[model samples]
Target: MTKIEDVKLIEIPKVKDSRGNLAIIEKDSLPYPIKRVYYLYDVPSDAFRGGHSHIAQHEFLIPLSGSFDVIIDDATNKKTVTLNKPDKGLHIVPGIWRELENFSSGSVCLVLASDVFLESDYIRDYQDFKLSKSR
Candidate 1:
């Protein structure tokens, strides 16, 4: 079973220059190899996203602009984490349920995924997720 303790906050290395600041995420920095990349943007304040759990996918979430809160549940305990900076990322392991909420306007959430899109890997029902965690 997965636990909230398995979640990690990783600091992305930043290069500061007069022109601008840049942050980088390498394969070695993550627990799983990157196979997919996606971003969330223009989310309304009252909206919620990501009410699902992955059977095998690992993810690293970064707030590139603005901020938001991520609620992670291992079916036994739950925790909320805020992402407000580009230099920080939340590493989410498999078998944990995650929900993204309270997105600030113009927020851009970048997700580095361990695998490509697969419908069969997602557990969309919360009850099903809880049941799976027990087994």
Candidate 2:
């Protein structure tokens, strides 16, 4: 069983240059080996994404551009995180529900996953997720 405290804000190594800055994420940056990489862009400000929890997957979310808020629920408590920096990432473990909202226009969310797409691993219903945590 994962707790809300388990969610963490990860800092990516950033190197500043005269013109711009570069943030990097190597294999050592995460706890799990990333197997899938995806992103979300052009999200409506009032819309939500990721209203579910995974059974076995872990994810690292980075705001590559603009900003957004991630609502994390652990069946016991809920917390909101604001992602506005390119060098910061949110690390999320399994057995916790998450929803992304308040996306600024042109915001891009990059996700690094521990596994390939697996529909069976996702718990989409909020009620079912709470019950699973109690077991």
Candidate 3:
């Protein structure tokens, strides 16, 4: 499992103009490089998502529309980071559990992952995540 030092924050630059603001996340921009890109939205105020940890994947999350916070748990410690700007992204390394919450209305959470979709790579339980990371 990777350590806290492995995680980082990335910023996605937005080109602003009278027409519109455009920001892009490509494979070369991410720390570990991006293999897949996805997004989340329509989250309720009383709800949460991402109570899982990755075994061998890295992710970079950004709030492309409104705002949201990603609470990352490194097993021994936890860090809470809010992403509001479309140009800013938070990088989550492998072996860390993350929970995304407090999404503003009409917010878009974009994720850039280093690996393709693999259900076996995820550790969904907190205790199980910690134990698996220790091994």
Which candidate gets the maximum lDDT versus the true structure?
Answer: 2
TM-score of each: 0.97, 0.99, 0.89
lDDT string for model 2 (1-135, tens) is 799899999999999999999898997989999999999998999999999999999999999999999999999999999999999999999988999999999999999999999999999999999999999
Clashing residue pairs, backbone N/CA/C < 3 A, model 3: 12-87
lDDT per residue as tens, model 3, 25-134: 66577668778889999998667889998888988888878988888887887888888988888888888889999999999998888999999999887889888867
Candidate 3 segments whose C-alpha is farther than 4 A from its true place: none
Candidate 1 residue-wise lDDT, 57-128, digit = tens: 999999999999999999999999999999999999999899999999999999999999999999999999
Q: Assess each prediction's global lDDT (C-alpha) against the native.
A: 0.95, 0.97, 0.84
Which ten contiguous residues of candidate 2 have the minimum total lDDT? Answer: 22-31
Between candidates 1 and 3, name the one with more favorable TM-score. 1
TM-score, candidate 3, is: 0.89
| Model 2, runs deviating above 4 Å | none
